[model samples]
Target: MNDPSPAAWLRPMLAVHRRALAAGCAAVLARTAAGLSLPYLVKVGIDEGVVPGDPDALSWAVLGCAAVIAVQAAAARIETLALARVAQRMLHAVRSRLFAHLQRLSLDFHERERVGGVVARITGDVASMQPLVAEALVNLVTSLVTMAGVAVVLVVLDWRLALAVLAVAPFLAVLVAWFRRRSATAWRRVREASAAASAEARESVAAVAVLQAFRREEVTLGRLAGRYGEERVANRRPIDLASMFFPAVEFGGAAATAIALAVGGHRVIDGALEIGTLAAFLIYLRLLFDPVFQLSELFDSVQSGTAGAARVAGVLAQRPSVQDPPAPVPLPAAGAELRMSGVRFAYPRADGEPGPEALRGVDLVVPAGHTLALVGATGAGKSTIAKLLTRCYDPDAGQITLGGVDLRATSEDELRRAVAYVPQEPFLFAGTVLDNLLLGKPGHDRARAEAALAAIGAEPAFRRLDGGLDTPVGERGEQLAMGERQLLAFARLWIDAPGVLVLDEATGHLDEESEERVQEALRRLRRGRTVVVIAHRLTTVTEADQVAVIDGGRVAQADPPAELLAAGGPFAVLHDRWLRSAAAG
Candidate 1:
């Protein structure tokens, strides 16, 4: 499946940049026409000029040959540049399209796929296709045109010699067929191995900190070595095939040349063929095999390209599970009550079968301008509720509504502006704090961002950030302290000013001092916003207007924080444990 051989993917892309394609085609035609003129001119020079001692004819032929060569050189240059332009355009389109598609795919898709494997699709898979666009296209068009032109000229010059050269055609066909079949399989393995190696390399780099902490560097190195070993074997198979295949093609050409010599020599000796005509026929005969050699390499390029294209196409084939309604209802601007009714969901396996339900038939409602905290043991579906509230993954069996509009029916733009979810660790791109804050409102004034940071008391730390707000965050904002990143995330929420907020353990990992800063930001952020907090520590829920105790994918109890403890129900056990843990601390 990874080796779809027809290059069906290329047609649509070529159509997209057809003007450049047309220019490249025109250049190719001119080049081929100019090139084919040479042998005929050679025949003219020797037979009519040199042999007959005609000085004018000889001079004319020489000048004509030089002029044709010049035209061919110019056309070749134009063809290369024009096709390179089309190739670059296609590459840009493919990368941009792939990146945008990945962004639009549902969160479930990203979670189900590994980071490294997904990166390989956009990076390695697209890279594998470069040769086909950059070089193979030109080679393919040139070789086919050259071969066709040469074949006609050879037959025109001497039919008997043409027959001799044509005898090798069937042999070349069979050899090419064998090479393509074997090389296709070989290249598919190579591509798969390459993807695997790339995945391992990226995964190791991304997790290097953890590996070093655990001192498992050697183990990771061994695994990487294994992946690379497989890749080396996969690459070797194709090289071995090419080594044999190309030499065989050369041998076929040599045989054709020998056959042409024997037949054409007899004809010239018997006064059936002119020496000049035999010379022209032989010259054109050599043109035939140049294409054969080039075509053989072109086949290699085709195999690599098709293998990569199939993988790229496979990614594009995915349909997002979460899609906007055909005609969406607009979310209301204010007093948006977030509600989930009898919602049920199961994380899907990679094979598309549903796994165990992460959220059961549960229902809840968060009154506008109130904080609802979800407290639960790990994997008790606390985070699942937050995810559903944010519409990262839609509930399978029920509807979530905002302001009485079904979240599915509401426009995503309206939904996003109405709700903001902050993960435990927020990600920042590799840029200045200003660049990351620009994500909230790309063209917003710089002074406003600085004011938001100061409002959250993050300005002092940010101002000290070497370049102030312009300091690069490094990857994922690792350059800043964890507390700084969390505060920056809150500033984003402030800028966007979503009416509903979902915080998943956002303050769970901070030091006491940093926690105070983040807690202060949360207080300012939660005012008048319908807040949903998935709390890992019960201490975080004491201020909540309401708390829901989740157990085994269902809400065990839901009530105000004080009443839940006074009720002495299932919430008592969790509250008691938190009290003792807090006392111990």
Candidate 2:
């Protein structure tokens, strides 16, 4: 009931290409007119030229038929070209808009939705509209016009034979209406099933490493086969319906033609109708049935296309959960102080149900040029604090300020430039090392990137590679070791030189040597910048100027590491456990 109509989704796209669509429509109409003129020309030639023994009339009629064929061919070519241009332009616009919108959407949206489903909507669903836009829409118009022209000519030639043809019209209409209702639901299932299969395929490919490691290749294959089977069943339903519908339409056409022939033959014998007129009536019936059958076939394509359009429209209708302020405040100069006041937050459940709070009313501050390490068990909101600092998710009931300005009020560009966050798992795109590094600060050349790598002591890893900066990172940086990826992340941070840095266990994946190197790089990078570390390693905690121990979505302790240990609080207990673990190792 809440579903959008096909026109609702298609209207905006059509409006954008209205001029081209209008031209295509004109061409289709011209082509239909030329086609309709041929039967009439045959009638004229038979009555005035062939029977009357006039060679000039017959020659002129033959020439007219030739001209009509030529015009029809030219008009059809122009119509196809014009409609194709409109369809391709619409596809480009829709795809670009969908991709850009996905980027603008909040991380919350991304977290809730499957990446494969989103990709399918962008690629498969959008592409499915091709038939509707390029062919079905235009062809449908042409069929209706041709049918109308044939009907008029049929009646004009012999009213009684036209009556016989009109007799089957109601039955054909009923058949089409029945097919439309059934096919819409069937095609919708097909689209849903296809999307599911696409999502499964993407997930399986992306996690092939895990599958192979667990030796579950057969299991995954079976799962994929099941998904594909569902898709096949969904696809078959509409096709089966169309197969039956087409034959029924053919039967109606045959019945009408038979009636026209038998009735018109009797009339001609009685001298009530001219032989040429009876012949034209039979030709007109064929013309009428041809378009009617074509329309029925086009209906199937339209149904499928509408199903795809509906899915695409649903995605485009979502407004971003996060948006820029109407009037943003200016960031202060020479101030890198970061503070959180009474911050409380919760991540919304994907199913729109209530979920546990990720963070509770908490307060913390770090000086303009100091470090604060957040230490806690997993899910104790350590990473949530870092996320809030980076403005990935705003707090439910608190204000986070950077440089004495509320983060929500600050411009996105300025805020991002001032605050940089590096997560535990660093991601590299499928490109050269230089390309990944340049993403840190746009317009910086290879020299600057090399300098940044050298500054972080990451140059040695790249030097071992054949092409250094030009070496491909492979998909998601799978080519490099985890340590190498983290080092590159540090090099990126150095290039950007932000006023504040938030690292959520940035060295978690590194070995001892890599960890030490990264820590040394961090020490240099922390100078004159507000640093917030979501500490996973004890070494990182010991080096922080202040430690914040979080428990149950709230900060239980906030003090220097030495002071907190002496106090024998939650931080003391955690530090003791960490020390014991290290000594045992």
Candidate 3:
């Protein structure tokens, strides 16, 4: 709930995007200065040309003022274009940093935060910053310049009148400061409410079918309505306050104008001031009001953007829990050999509840080009072992080694190239069939991809498509069945050819026939690669050269499946239950 400091990020926008920043500033400054010339032109026209009854001079001055106005208009257009380019460049940098940081963040972070919230921050939140950079920033400087220029001209016209106008300045300053503080908080609430709504809506839509099937349509609707209602309430309060803001300022500015007229009119009537000079003073007074009016109207946008900027900076400020090593361990020439010695891990639990350990001093090793199957019931540290092997979360106590080198010393890029993991629920991006596959190996050609697809029995499915590799996959691969998605994920994994492969319930969704096909594909992929399979099906683990039974965060048994079955231990009970269940089904 703490807001990020704007200076934490925006200050660096200048250093990083120097050329764009410079161009934006130059354009805005030139335009603002040109705009400042308009009041001076009016003063000249009134005093020197219009007052003299000189028709030719009056015509020439009027035309000159028109020309200045046109130039100011052209400068304003150029400045807008320049500011837009600068804003886009800054947005690109912010998005790039967020993406790169996301890749480096630990799995624990992802588990703790909702996908909808993160997506909203990156897409919706960053987009809110456009007005800040493009309009608010440029106008802030321009308003300052115009205010200063008008004040100087007023003082030159008459010190007493200038001092009178300046009397209301303190009140304006107080109002700006007060509004900025209050409006910033209001805008922050608006953004938070928006993110909350986005997260709830995203979750609801993703589980729409479940909600309908469970007959919870009214419940879901009520929840959504509650969220939207909060958003509406939060939104209206600020708008209501902001609506009163301009009207108040206009009333105050008008009162100041009346006072100026009353005081200045007496000086003119008493022959103490020229008619032309008084006219010039009136024009200068209007010019003074222009900046104040602009400041009043734009405060809401400026404050809102300031709040959004703080949110963006806060997201950027998060330090990735997992980072690359300063000096990376070189890739082993003979491929990967994974070892875990005395590893332990525990998930932080609540104060009143028991803090359960997930992994406890577990030691295991998998030789190069071998398959290790971990068989256990739910919450038996099976998935935790897989996570540790990949260094997704470093063991609290012991060493994880790849090719006899400590994994903590390995560079992230090197580790990623050496290891590939397919989770229980595989995700597919929205793109063509080839696009998802290419993510596995960015530079891989179509021939290589097709070979991988063929290995996984996916080539026939690909051929059945209207455009083969060009066919689009719906969001999260909703277009394909679960088993088909798993097969496609294997095809992708095969193209990468990483030194180590970790499969977490890869065949969970497959029926007997589909499981056989995918098992065959997995077997083909296993050769010459280190494979770690977290298995639920007894039949699959029975095929591994070695199987380890995990119980209570420790390895209960480690041997070949046949040997473990013959011994009649924990694995025997699990295998029995799995077989009985399969028979029943």
Ranking by TM-score: 1, 2, 3
* Tens digits of per-residue lDDT for model 2, 1-585: 123665765688689888999999999999999989898888889989998999999999999999999999999998999999999998898788889888877788788778898898898888888888888878788988988888888877777778776998999899988999999999999988999999999999999999999999999999999999999999899989989999999899899889888888898899998787878787888888888777787877778788888888777677666567989887755437889999999887866554789888989989888899999888999888988898878888989998778999976777788888988898899998899998877799999999998887778878998988898999999888888888888888888888888988878878898888778877877888899999988999989999999998999999999999899988888888988998998
Off by over 4 Å in 3: 1-3, 16-24, 49-52, 333-335, 348-356, 456-467
Give model 1's TM-score versus the native structure. Answer: 0.96
Write down the lDDT of every candidate, Cα atoms only: 0.86, 0.86, 0.80
RMSD of each: 1.9, 2.1, 2.6
**Candidate 3 least-lDDT 10 residues:** 347-356
Candidate 3: pairs in clash = none
Per-candidate clash tally: 0, 0, 0
RMSD of 2: 2.1
